[model samples]
Target: MPTSRELREVKAHFYSLAGFPNVIGCVDGTHIPIQSCGGDEAELFRNRKGYFSINVQVVCDANLLIRDIDARWHGSAHDSTVYHNSFLRARLDNNEIDGHLLGDSAYPCGRYMMTPILNTSTNAERLYNVAQIKTRNTIERTFGVWKRRFPCLSQKLRIKLEHTLAVIIATAVLHNIAIQQNDTVSIDNSPEEDIISAESNMQPLTSEGNHYRRLLLEQYFM
Candidate 1:
C-alpha cells in the first residue's frame, strides 16, 4: 500500500499529467488464469470468460507503480464487489488514503472513488466522463506494462493456487522495484482481458460525492 505522502505525491503528478485534481490512484481488477484446484472452489474460481482464475484488484499510481494490490478474490467476483470487501475500501472511507481514486463505470462513484457519468446526461457530464476516462487510462496502461514486463502474468500459470498468488505478488513487487530503479521499461499496448461487470445503477449516489463531481464539471470541465 502507498503511504499518505506517496499518495499525495502521486496525486500531484496526476494533476500535472492530466489536469484532473486530487487523483491518488486508479482502481481496476484484472484476472489471472490458474490451474484448476478441484473442489467447491473450482467452480467459484471460474469467471465469466470461462476459466479458473483470480480477480486481482490493483491501485496504481501515476508513475505506474502498483500502490496496492489484492489477488485473493475469485475471478467470478465483480469489480465493485471485490472493492467493497477490500481493506482499501475501509481505508478510503476512513480517509486513510488522502485523495480520490479514478475508476471506470464498473466501480461506483463516491467521495474517494471517482467514476465516470454512466449515461452522459449532460454536456458537462459527457466532458467530465471524457476527462475521467483519459485520466483513468493510467491503470490500463499500468496493467499492460505489468503483464508485458512479466510475461508470465499474461500467461496461464501451471502452479498451484498458493504459488500462483506468490508469483503474482512477487512479480508486482519486482515491477515496482524495476520502476523505482529506472530500469529500461517496455510498455506493450497489447490489451489484457478484463471482466466488465455492471454498475449498481439503482444504488443511491452520495450527496457530497455528487456535489464534488458537479463542482469539477462546472469549474474544470465546463
Candidate 2:
C-alpha cells in the first residue's frame, strides 16, 4: 500500500497524462499459463481461452510500478470476482486509500474504482472515456514489462500449484525492484498474441458511483 503522500504523487502523475484526477493506480487481470493440477479441480484451472492458468489481478502506478497483486485465483475466475475478494478491495472499502483505481468496464464502478462509461452521447462523456482509457493503460503496459522480464510467467509453469503461486508473487516483487533500479525491458517490439482482451461482462455501478463519475466529468472533462 502507498502512503498518503505517495498516493498524492501518483494521482498528480496520472492527472498530468490525461487530466483524470484522483487516480492512484490502474487495475487489471492477466492469465498466467500453468500445467494442469491433474485432479477434479484441474478443469477449474482452464480459462475461457481453453488454457490452464491462473488469473492474476494486478494494480500498478503511473510509473508502471506494481502496487498490489493477487495471484491466488484460478484462470476461470472473473476479473471482478478476484478483485471483490482481494485484500486491496477491503482497504479501499474502508477508505484506507485516499485515491481511486482505474479499471475496465468488467469491474463494478464505485467510489474507489472507476470504469469506462458504456454509453456516451455528450462530448464530456467522450472525453472522459478517452482520458480513462489513456490513464488505465498503465496496467496493460506493466503486465507486458513484468512478463517480458520473467519469461516463466508468459510460458507454462510446470511446477506444483503451490509453487506456481509463489513464483507469480515473487516475480512481481522482482519487477518492482527492477523498475526502482531503472532496469527495465523494452516492450516496443513485443508481439500482441499473448495479450488478453479486456472482459466485456460489464458490472453495474452503484448509485454513489454513478453520481461520482458524473461529478468527475462535470468538474474536469467538461
Worst 10 residues of 1 by lDDT: 195-204
lDDT of 1 at 137: 83
Model 2 C-alpha lDDT versus the unseen true structure = 0.89
**Clash pairs, model 1 backbone:** none
* Residue-level lDDT tens digits of model 1 in 79-138: 888899999999888877677888877776788888877678788788778778788888
How far in Å is the alpha carbon of 167 misplaced in model 2? 0.6
RMSD of 1: 2.2
List per-candidate RMSD values in Å: 2.2, 1.5
**lDDT of all predictions, in order shown?**
0.81, 0.89
Instruction: Quote the RMSD, in angstroms, for model 2.
Output: 1.5
